[model samples]
Target: MKDKLFKNLLHNAKGYSVLNSGGQLVKGYKPDTVLQKGNEYIIMECDTGTSRKGYLGAMLKAARFLSNEKKGVLVLVIKEKPNTKVKQIAEHLQEYLIWLQPLTNLNIVYLIESNRYCPDENPLELLSSEFITTATIIKSD
Candidate 1:
């Protein structure tokens, strides 16, 4: 139920070409969607588990390569409300973001929890909010 709900929401995101790569056509690394916004390539990894370091590592590698070609943002959307496990995962993601940003030269990294959005809201709107806000701040600097 949860999975299908989130899948539909991601499928409906606007202003971004959302690729549903979660079909697992490939081995090892399959993210929920890949979003292209201008010069940016956002790999959206939607997960039910909070502690999936192996999976995250693979996504990070993909993001690194994509960033070299274009700007990158790893938008990790976890499908549950805030909890200790999720908090820990978010912190780990942030740590990786800090480490990878300089290496990847990415503009920003976003970690959004599913509870923040209405089912009717486009998922891209949430992603754009973060990127737009970050771009504004970056431009001002």
Candidate 2:
């Protein structure tokens, strides 16, 4: 999730390979999940607990790669606000990333929706340059 998102794969659904310094990624030198448009590279990594920290190391690695690529817009598609969970995770990750990769040039956004994921009515826009713009992701019931 971290690598794919930072690599802009989430935006373009491009294929990616996770390589290690020893020339092998984890999972026994196997590749990670296949890319799929509009499906979360990870569905639970951004939650307040259980897997948020899993991102710290990954975030640092991703940030380094992104900085090399000059990508600064780090977005998290969330289900909406008053989501203390999202907010907490955002703050924690923001701080951790700052301290861990202080040279990273990027901004993070916790995007919200009424739906669990992106729906047909609205999809993530590629033209927007703003870091934290609010977007409507679901239709009203």
Candidate 3:
């Protein structure tokens, strides 16, 4: 599953150069993969674990990456739909961010992988109240 997800992301990133792969540490965060196209950075973190910790950790990493990078997109790839616990965590994180009011622009993408063979279909935009206010969902084929 991990391999398929990684492959799908690579396929989607056609012209991007792979900056990091196989969980190499970068600025204290070890994302599954990182790609760069021109001046835009795309940071990807895949979550296949069956626990709340995994989702929370991924969200935390997204926050960290968005906070640090001036121009980048953080994609959180998941094998299945997030559960209630995960949603609750997102809400809490959203509240924290609202209070802190960081100036950086947050472009977080949630990719739900449904098909390993084709992972670039059924694109959807997430509502502001669903998870993070600026988060979007991109369902895989």
Which candidate comes out best when scored by TM-score?
1
Model 2: how far is 67 from its true place, Å?
A: 2.8
Worst 10 residues of 1 by lDDT: 132-141
lDDT tens per residue, model 2, 8-103: 333332342222222223333322222222312211122222355644544554454344445433334443335344555555576665564556
Write candidate 3's Cα lDDT for 1-97 as tens digits: 4654564443335467777775654567877766777656667666656565665566556556655444565565555544533344344445434
- Clash number for model 3? 0
CA displacement after TM-score superposition, residue 141 of candidate 1 (Å)? 12
| Best first by TM-score, ranked | 1, 3, 2
**Model 1 lDDT, residue 69, Cα:** 61
Which wins on lDDT, candidate 1 or candidate 2? 1
Tell me the whole-model lDDT of each prediction, alpha carbons only: 0.54, 0.36, 0.51
- Cα RMSD to native, each candidate? 5.0, 9.9, 7.1
| Candidate 1 residue lDDT tens string, 16-133 | 6765556542355566666666766666656666455743574476556554567655656665535524355655555555566655745454555555443345544645554344
Best candidate according to lDDT: 1
Instruction: Output the lDDT of residue 116, model 3.
Output: 33
If both were scored by TM-score, which would come out higher, candidate 1 or candidate 3?
1
